[model samples]
Target: MSLRNNPKKSMKLPLTTRTNQVVRRKLQQSSGPFPRQSTNKPQRRPTRIRTTNPMQLLSNPAPNDRAEEQRKLRMAQNRLSSRNKRLKRRQLSRVAKIQHTSR
Candidate 1:
């Protein structure tokens, strides 16, 4: 009888064993995704830990010198000048609004 009509006759020979052997050989030759892990090897540690506070450097900063004092004075003068300019602009806008309303 034909092997198609009797699959048990095909398995009675070395055909099914040959296919299993070929599949096992292919699996051993190729490194699939699930490679066997070794318990003897230690796990890898991260290079750097990310749990540090970013503002720790600002907590203990450099000592203020004469250059720092000069910078502070310049910043204060700039703030005063900007405030005066803003007040002048507001006063001019208010005068223009009043003139327009009167007209």
Candidate 2:
């Protein structure tokens, strides 16, 4: 018997394919040109340009500007800890070597 003739076998199609077919048919019906409307909206206000020098702006920072300082402090602390770790490891290995040689 052919697969198309089998009623029980035809019921096993995925749910998503059936939903997509329905959505595509609905979209095809709604595809058309939009109706025109009035375009008399008021013009937007222009933004004020700052005439002050950028260097002056940086010299006098805004109130909420501690993020950069905090980041630099964290970076410096990380570097110091990493250096201390390396120094401690080198000293450990040197002491081990000296002990081995003296034995």
Per-candidate TM equals 0.38, 0.39
* Model 2 TM-score (2 dp): 0.39
Q: Compose the digit string of candidate 2's lDDT tens values, residues 31-103.
A: 6532332355457899655447878657655545556767888999999999999999999999999999999
RMSD of each: 11.5, 13.0
lDDT of 1: 0.76
Model 1: per-residue Cα lDDT over 1-103, one tens digit each: 9987998887776878969988889879877533445445677987643334647534533456446867998999999999999999999999999999999
| RMSD after Cα superposition, model 1 | 11.5
| Stretch of 10 with least lDDT, candidate 1 | 32-41
Off by over 4 Å in 1: 1-64
Tell me the TM-score of model 1: 0.38
Worst 10 residues of 2 by lDDT: 32-41
